[model samples]
Target: MEQQKFEKMYLMQTVQKTIVILRAFTKEQPKLSLTELNKKTGIGLSSLQRFVATLVYEGFLIRDDRTKQYQLGLSLIHLGKLVEEESSIITIAQPILQQLNKATKESISMSIIDGNERRCIMNIESSYALSARNHVGDTSPLYAGASAKSLLAFLPQEEIDQYLDEVAMEHVTENTVVDREQLLEQLQEIRKQQYVFTRAERIIGACSFSTAIISNGRPVASIAIIIPEARFDEEQFDELRELILHAKFDIEKQLNK
Candidate 1:
């Protein structure tokens, strides 16, 4: 217990140090030398050198050899753009998601790619007492559910191939697809249809209908309606499909604007 506590404190200190090092570079001092950074961050010069070197190696900071100064790197710009896009997507899709949730009285959600996983960025709970439950910030494997597969289906062919080759496919539930070739085939079909409907692939008692939100001919996010299996009506599948697709269209239309 003592060792674990010490390790946790050490990790926290390392993270805080990293944040301080990055914060040392501001508009007033966009470029800083190791000495300047050490002074600004109040870290020892030796420790600061290690942190700055690691940051530079990771592309979070760039060092100018001639001037011996460091500045924020392109990776930070890319991360900033991603943050802006996620915020914009939520703002653009909120009303459409609200309407869809109201129409079906089921849980509605939006997901985006986060590394090799799909992350729920926005979610509206179902109105019914016995509805599917998913929370904002929930994450799931891309091979599992309608919410995940919708985004995965729209990725570039090479990226899709890379992901399939790299990530281990695990069955989240008995119905989850763990076969690579079968999953590839299913993704192809989803691409052709531009939507996916799945049952009990992630959560055991849930069904979801999902479609990608496209911008500039590329998928940026996915929208989903999640329903409890007990509440799902096969007879109403077509109506639910239409509502989800229309929600997709409306959100994408706004995204393209």
Candidate 2:
């Protein structure tokens, strides 16, 4: 009886109970009625009503008045985008980026596909005097460079098709793939190899090696090393690929955690 009281008291934490209610919905079972939610969450009917009302009011949930079922709301997607933009990948990749800088002695960056473009959210420079010219906020077309290909390779099939159908490829350099058929083939190759190497594609005199960091079955960001064409060594290509892959794995692991 004493243990039962303690258990009941523990469940009284509003935040914990709210999270439990939210977690009751899954990918397999995205919508649930009030009775279903109560059964799954082990929340009593009265308390569940209060929590559901509050969550719905706050835009965390949407209720179907006709069916009396509830589903996740647009607010969660908005919150997820904010987290993607501000925290998870960037915060998790910082240490990995530092380590890559030390290992490669080349400029390293993390790029995310933002709409039809990719944004360089983080760039760590090598200790060496000369390196690639990339800043934290640099944005480039998703159809152009090694970093862009690494991201484009793992996007969903519909999104990829939409991209190919809509966007016009600009000829940034002679190496840039402005042809749709050729670029689609290249994207497939990148998906298979899990990396991309580009020579003066986006910028003249800059070569890049990149691989995507996939989380939850899709590419969230890409890890890349940029070097001047004069300094980029074919002999070091395999070594650099391995280094970027390791960093990608590290970031993905953190994201999963």
Q: Number of the top candidate by lDDT?
A: 1
Pairs that clash in candidate 1: none
- Report lDDT (Cα) of residue 15, candidate 1: 99
| CA lDDT of every candidate | 0.91, 0.89
Candidate 1, 125-204: lDDT as tens digits: 88999888668889999999998999999889999999999999998999999999999999999999889999999999
Cα distance off (Å), candidate 2, residue 133: 3.3
C-alpha positional error of residue 256 in candidate 1 after TM-score superposition, expressed in Å: 2.4
The alpha-carbon deviation from the true structure for residue 150 of candidate 2, after best TM-score superposition, in angstroms, is: 0.7
Cα deviation at 196, candidate 2, in Å, is: 0.5
Question: What is the model-wide C-alpha lDDT for candidate 1?
Answer: 0.91
Residues 1-257, candidate 2: write the lDDT tens digits: 99999888877788899999889989999999999998999989999999999999999999999999999988889878867744888888999989999998899998888889999988998777877857888999898899888999899989998988888788999989998889889999999998999999998999999999888788888889999998887999899989988888888888898
Give model 2's TM-score versus the native structure.
0.71
State how far residue 218 of model 2 sits from its true place (Å). 1.3
| Worst 10-residue lDDT window, candidate 1 | 129-138
